[model samples]
Target: MALAGLKVIEIAGLAPAPFAGKVLADFGADVVRVDRSTSTMNLDVLAQNKRSIALNLKSPAGIEALIRLCEKADVVIEPFRPGVMERLGLGPEVLLKRNPRLIYARMTGFGQEGHYAKMAGHDINYLAISGVLNERSKSGKGQVVDAAMINGVNYLGSFVYNMNKAGALFQTPAGTGQLDGGAHFYDTYKTKDGLFMAVGAIEVEFYKLLLKGLELDEERDKLPEQTDSSNWPKMKALFTKIFLGKTQAEWIKIFDLTDACVTPVLDYYSMPTPTPAPRLLRTPAKASASNEGSDVFLEVGGHSKDILAEAGFSEVEIRDLVAKKAVAGAGLEKSSL
Candidate 1:
């Protein structure tokens, strides 16, 4: 719990926004979600271990109340159209001025400043612009795989990963700014069984060992360019041959010891526990959203009765919110995985 003592304020929204808050809170930060006053407490698995304060952000008084929370918060998370928060008078400019050390996190489909900044888009559109989608496709077959994986994986890594690294960028011991960290050389390599291995980094030793493990002619040279004409056929043939001779477990054993970076490709569920090197561990929690339930990492808070009280939930308000879908708990069941 490196972040055990930090305090965060989450301006409730969908998907990645809530996700970011959860990651921080799970890592032992005090995350208070400012839920929509009329929002039902649909507790998704990712939201486990976090508390909620139901409030109407549209109300000026409500917005002001959140600003006050921001003044005491080390970080704030909001995902809205670029200036929507600004219009609500809760933008970074206003809040950041009040607390200069505050980490004002804004999550959006596009970035805060760009031609598409103001345009409406979702995860697919964002990946499309970043060259991620095109690269994910093979030979332009027009098939759409789990693009949500790209969105969730990349965005989660970006926000949570950067949140951990944000302390590095400031001039003083502590200051605040934004960071956009995305995936680099993490992807799949072709296999002999017509399967592919999703490898990462492709480091020098890995390149050498891959050449060695495949038993390629030592004198044969590797092509540097990644274009179709340069990469397919020959490389695919070799990979197919190398992997065709062995099961995935066999290959994992051979490569696991070397710096030869390699991993067997798997769908989300098929991935093994204690996965390859540089493994990350986070608290386990179940969350549900839009009728879909899955386990997710949670960033949590210190228990406080007053914090819950400040949420202003009357017995009637609580019952009504639940009845009308205004509040939710971590309404998730255990996933088999």
Candidate 2:
């Protein structure tokens, strides 16, 4: 309801752009996804809470129809390589001129003007270039942030850039950073039942509580200081052996409501619903189901007539567009709009 009156046009692309549109739609914005006439993948989850209108961007009629929609849209989100939109005559420069107040958001792997702007890359590539991939867990495997390429390039910091300026941050091999698994107290361990537990007792008091909960207090005097990097492997091995003695649930019970900062690593299906932060009494966040219908997946141009009519096109014009193969929708011939 917060975005009840906002109008957004999202050019159909891959994961990130659709996700951005879905967030807007979830907040009550009228999000219309301009889908291509042909698409190879089904992105139903990302298409939830949004409407789809199939348009052939290669056609002049399709381009004109999109421009008309943008004239009234508050926002336009497009994900393409740097000159793609411009070549289609729908770039920010052209659209912003038609509607000066339009917020044209362009999503790409690299920025629009950089040397790597036109290069083909995905989330992993972006993370690698940004130095995020360089940091790994004790397993020596890089962690991936799905759909991170969009937010990472657009809003999130390039970690390497900050590290370069700070001068204190250095590139060691994986599992060598204080927080990136170099610290024994802040790593994951497998349990007796094959489940995993995440331990993050970073503060001194919390670390003390963790040791107490693990019943390793008797060996504290013999163990190296928590900040000593040289002792991490030994501490990690000891912790791993101790944790293997208990199931994930058993450890959770021991650390329940305590400052030990231990929790079971939940899988996707078992992940808990996090309460929205800064909880509001009014208009609180609520999850909505994906759009219903068999046509929800792998279908484009499902709302061509309705979208065109809403954009001030006449019935004759809509029919002509559809007939010309510039626009399409399911059962367009039978629709009375």
Candidate 3:
């Protein structure tokens, strides 16, 4: 009901924009999926709660119709290549100038510039370009690498490959090893509130501390051997029962001061923001000392004069650039760049 009056114009695409429109639709927004006249994309799950329309963008009549619709809409979700909307005379700058309050969300992969900007891309292309495909590469030299989606996912389990050489130890059935989630201490348990708590007290000291935090240290002598694979099921049952007795927040408070390596399994948006990982030994990043905030969201050519001047352009050159429409947004202002 939060978005009851919101109207969203979704230019149909393969995945991203449709999913977003679906979410908006779910929240009571009026989402109209504008499919191309020739599109064969069915009313799939993403189109569940929305309406659809076919429009031939190439036609002047269709373009005018869409522009008129956008003039009355709140948001336009466009996921085409960078300049496609501008080429069709429906760019954010043009639309925003007409409606003034409309939200234009330009979605793209590999950004608006670079080699892949104009290329048709999918999930694999995204994974490969983002360095995710080589997360475990040891080679320092550049080399050609190729993989299908399935092969790329299978390679991520390479961590368990070394155990394959351990003879009898490797003979342990899959999903029955400690790190494979066979041990109670290295698994997730449901809490009273239906959320989950991840307990990974792998080390003996941490495990002991975990027991102390959970108030289970008194029964530590009665508990089965922590590393005995044969006793894993009973241990798992015991931990599961105990974990559900308290909410995740309660357990967090209990274990916050202990070295238990315990944490809640939070949903995507609810997860806490982690600090940036890389740190310099001497000049490591820290909270800014200044209280000043600098947030400047500029229009397309808002900083044209400033950018040219910073690049060593004279005041006369900046004026000429603006006069010639080579630069934009600055209209004969007294404060020259």
Candidate 4:
């Protein structure tokens, strides 16, 4: 709901542009997708929580209508090749001049001005061009073993048994295994504020850092050897008491960046919710020939009467535009998540 009441005019296109609009819509922005009236490319995959108005950008009336929409909009999402908007007279300069506070976005594959700016590409194409395709995780050749989760976990017993053979596991009782909440450094401790902090400082260096962050002086505290299982119960007791002295937030302040493997066990409400991406905080989209541009048009939109009226289009003008095939009055037949 952070973007509620914000007006966004999204020039319909493929994944990148429509996805940006979808995110804004998800965050409660009032998005109006500008789709081509004659095209039937429905961008419903990312059209949730948005409205649409079909327009024939190739026509003069359609371009004028789009200008009007952007004149009062908080944001305009343009997904076209570099010169496409300029050729259609819908470039950012004209829109920003009409509404200086407007936020114009250009969603493109290669960007506004690049060797491939005007070229057609998608996620895979860009990844390939960026050499991401060459970076693949390959494993040693072996008999492939793919199975359902229920079956896969059962087969993993062979690997677990292999570890159990080296006297490296199950050395203690069921609750005292080194990685199974048995080691004091590999368990969760309660904080003074009733929250919990998870500790995984198993490595020697990490354990030292954890102790340092905990202010546990080696000489003064006379701590037992870390690997001495005979003294683990005592260590657990000490860690439990020490952790209870501070709140989770206080502990995080000390260990968050210390590489101590200590972190708060956050609940859903305590976690940071991810917001939309590719945003313009300052220096919003400006009109310039050298700016980024794209060339991808998708058809979608409806509710032309209401949207056009909001853009100051006259009742008669709206009817005439529709009559001229420059605008459409119906919206997407259906949309979903």
- Candidate 2, residue 176: Cα displacement in angstroms equals 2.0
Backbone clash count, each prediction separately: 24, 1, 0, 13
Q: Which stretches of candidate 4 lie over 4 Å from their true place?
A: 131-299, 331-337
Off by over 4 Å in 2: 131-174, 218-221, 273-281, 290-299
Superposed by TM-score, candidate 3 places the C-alpha of residue 301 at a distance from the truth, in angstroms, of 4.6
**Candidate 1 C-alpha lDDT tens digits along 114-182:** 678778776667666652234212442221112232344466557554655775432222211212211
Worst 10 residues of 2 by lDDT: 139-148
lDDT of the structure predicted as candidate 4: 0.72
Q: How would the candidate models be sorted by lDDT, starting from the highest?
A: 2, 4, 3, 1
Instruction: Report every candidate's CA lDDT.
Output: 0.56, 0.77, 0.65, 0.72
- Tens-digit lDDT track for model 3 on 1-337? 5567777888877567776776676566777776664444353346645666555577665565567667777778887877898999888777877776676766676567777777877777776665322321254222212222333444664555555555524466767877767888899999999999999998999998888877776365587767888999888898899999999999888887678989889897786543322444553333222222322111222333443443355788656544443333324344544
lDDT (tens digit, per residue) of candidate 2 on 120-209: 987778876764323232443322112236447544665655764687454566678666788899999999999999999988899999
Error of 3 at 143 (Å): 16
- Which regions of candidate 3 deviate over 4 angstroms? 1-175, 215-222, 265-302, 315-337
Q: Which of candidates 3 and 4 is the stronger one according to TM-score?
A: 4
